[model samples]
Target: MMGPTHALSAGVAFLAVATPMSHYVHHLTPATAAVGTVVAAGAGILPDFDHRQATPARAFGPLSAALAWTIGKLAGGHRHGTHSIIGTGVFVALAAAATLNPWALAATLWLCMGLAVRALWKHPPNRPNGKLDYRDVAGLIHAAIAAYIAYQLVHSGLDMGVVPWAVAVGYLVHLIGDSMTEMGVNWLWPHPRRYRIASIDTGKTVEKRVVVPALYVGLAATVYLTYPKWGPVLLHTLQPTTG
Candidate 1:
């Protein structure tokens, strides 16, 4: 699958997870949700570091390329090591260590902010010509919301334990994505055999053109169907509490 597909899939998976931050760290503002969504998406594809040419690896730049080389060497190449149970466990444990620690929340805050900043960078909060444009206004609004999210996460001193689980879920989503391919992933590593119920050729026209779209559409439909149950939760989480 392509980078966009993996990202969108992971984002959808994140939406399916709950965040304790809603009650402890921060309210479930759109900004916080957006940050969480991006984190989950990145984690979803993080296991692909073994494939240097893989979308996630390329997006991370040269440093990631080197890491991919090392991972590839250790795992005996892509879709072997990181695609297995051991890899998933390692990722989850590491992520939990980072996300569940009180002090580590600062790094997580910075990470989320960076993601939000990069997204709004193209919108430019100010124009060189001195005239304000929709982009500038939009950028300011985005920055403000993200800043608020970062503040809550940083000062609340709450253990954002849910974040790591959400990321792990995203990784599982990636495994599921790989499972639907002809070159099935060895999900249960050390056990051998790439297990898959159905196989679709990865990077082929069918996958990019047909399968990806279908998955997204299905995701959208699921969201729509489930919105009724989640809508009230969002309202309560985001709405200001009354004294």
Candidate 2:
């Protein structure tokens, strides 16, 4: 699956289960649900840190590029160690540990937001003769959004304990998405055996035309179901006022 598709899938998955699971999971709150949704969307693209040219790699100019390069090398190339079940557990552990320190958690949230925005937000079309590519403009906008969300998340009084679960679910969702593609992921990495159920081509007709669109629909439906009051709020905001 491609970056946007992966993001949408994870976001949908998170929202779909967040409400029902909230009953058993004491840390969940409205604020946490909203924040976790975004974080999960970003985490969906985290495994692709093994690909130097992937969206997360280029999201933050040279800093992220360097980080991606380093992770890619350490993970032994794309879809290897980082795409495995062990990799997912490692990410969850790291996320859990990061929550112990406020600064580390803030940085992690910021990076996740940046990755999600890079994948999910629509960029302007490139100009044929312009000196500045609009894609750069979009990048600046995404960075601003990421920074704002990160700041809000750091300050929001919501419980931070559920974040590691969000990270874990998002990472697993990404692996599952890849498992549906023709190039399946190795669930147990070092063993070299891959598990697959479907053969959808990444970014091709099935993905671009079918899978992504369906995921978008699923996201919308899940969001509606998760946030029932949002519909009334949206309607109230959109309703015209008369003196």
Candidate 3:
């Protein structure tokens, strides 16, 4: 239910120094700072794995597809498993596990990428099995590139320690955003019943026009308030200068 924009905004909000999460991540060095942001923001898109057309699924391709298939099959597909506490637990567990061994994680990603490429090239998308659609090719490439970027970041001296927490925080933020939608999440595990705000709808005028703009504002505000580049200046302006 949470759109990519809102989820990313929530991630940014969580990353902001003003947020509770800042205590753990505020000490990050310049190089790893953006990496932290990327981890969090990327994680924000995790819940949407059920929707093949969703950006998270598109960006992650076969990796997302596999996860979606597995969880969906377990919870009756799209919008059910991924929206429940049990499903969320599965996501967070996978995220935490990946950070424990970056090399193995990278290898898994490579395998997924290879499969995606094969699906796009060797096999036709229309097999009637709905495994790999022709439209998924571009997304697979993008997902592969994202996977490579993470691999390089791991190899290039970035701390993997920050990853699991960032991913968890981002995933939770996505859930919160989705809770605001009319079709809310099942939040409780093993229970299919959903809960929502009862007023908001996904992709409606309110979401596109109001919610999206609000997300932009929230992102901008978070950056202005917490970004190292701008935070110091804002604080400096707020404090009375010592003559």
Q: Residue by residue across 1-243, what tens digits does model 2's lDDT show?
A: 678898989988888878666778645766677778888999999999998767787676556667888999988899999999999988899999989988778878988878888787645432233244555556566667777777677777668877788898789999998998888999998889988979777556777888889998998777767567445655675689978
User: Comparing 1 and 3 by lDDT, which wins?
Assistant: 1
Winning model by lDDT = 2
Reference-based lDDT, each prediction? 0.63, 0.80, 0.59
lDDT, candidate 1, 124-167, per-residue tens = 32234334456445544554565566567767644455566556
Please say which candidate is ahead in lDDT: 1 or 2.
2
Model 2, global lDDT: 0.80
* Clashing residue pairs in candidate 3 (N, C-alpha, C atoms within 3 angstroms): none
- State how far residue 159 of model 2 sits from its true place (Å): 1.5
Tens-place lDDT per residue, model 3, 103-141, is 755643343333223322332332233566655675566
Candidate 1 lDDT score at position 37: 67
Worst ten-residue run, lDDT, model 2? 122-131
Which stretches of model 1 miss by more than 4 angstroms?
A: 17-35, 100-159, 228-243
Evaluated with TM-score, which candidate comes out highest? 2
